[model samples]
Target: MIDKIKRIVEPVVQDFNAELVGVTLKGAKRNYILIVFVDRIGGVTIEDCTKISRQLSKEQELDDLLGNNYRLEVSSPGMDRPLKTPQDFKRNVGRFLEIEFEDKAGLHKLK
Candidate 1:
């Protein structure tokens, strides 16, 4: 399901001169979440979200790809996507963030 979503979104992101930062699926059963990430500056507007959502929804509906009872969510990563790599941190420098690390247990501010 996730791979299918990625295939559909990647081109759209690239067309907008953005990259797919990441994609996440969380939840069990019928209520599922689809969180998409894009390397966007100045954050993505609601219109952008709507456009991407509509495009993806249309693709999914046309192909009947999901093939199950589930919901779809389309949005930018916000500040929660994390700076997994140094490049990520570099790109998001000076922005407010809430980070929860796996290896180290601490919340530190980034600049």
Candidate 2:
């Protein structure tokens, strides 16, 4: 479902020059919540989120993709969001970071 959402949402997001960071769907059949995370080089703004939301809601395919009873949210992943991919790390270069991982020794961290 997430893959489908990404496939459907990616182009619409890029039309505004934003990257779709992630998507999550939750809740029962009647109250599904779809959260989309968007980002770009200069960061995203409320207007960006607003535009994305409007565009996404205007997509007929998305309506059929998720059925008729769901709410969509568009927003940034927020400050202190964990960096997951090589590209994510690369994009955040020179910014302070906190990394924590677990191993046989229990846990380790790098700042």
Per-prediction TM-score to the true structure, in the order listed: 0.63, 0.83
Ten contiguous residues minimizing lDDT sum, candidate 1: 60-69
Error of 1 at 44 (Å): 1.4
Superposed by TM-score, candidate 2 places the C-alpha of residue 75 at a distance from the truth, in angstroms, of 0.7
- 1-111: candidate 1 lDDT, tens digit per residue: 778778777897776656677888787655566677776655667777777766666665424644466566766766555467775776676777665434366555543
- Give the Cα error of residue 11 in candidate 1, in Å: 0.6
Residue 94's lDDT within candidate 2 is: 76
Task: Write candidate 2's Cα lDDT for 9-108 as tens digits.
Answer: 9999999999989999999777889999998876889999999999999988878977888999999888778888886766677767788899998999
Per-candidate Cα lDDT values, in order, are 0.67, 0.89
Assess the local accuracy of residue 68 in candidate 1 as a C-alpha lDDT between 0 and 100.
Answer: 62
Give me the overall lDDT of model 1.
0.67
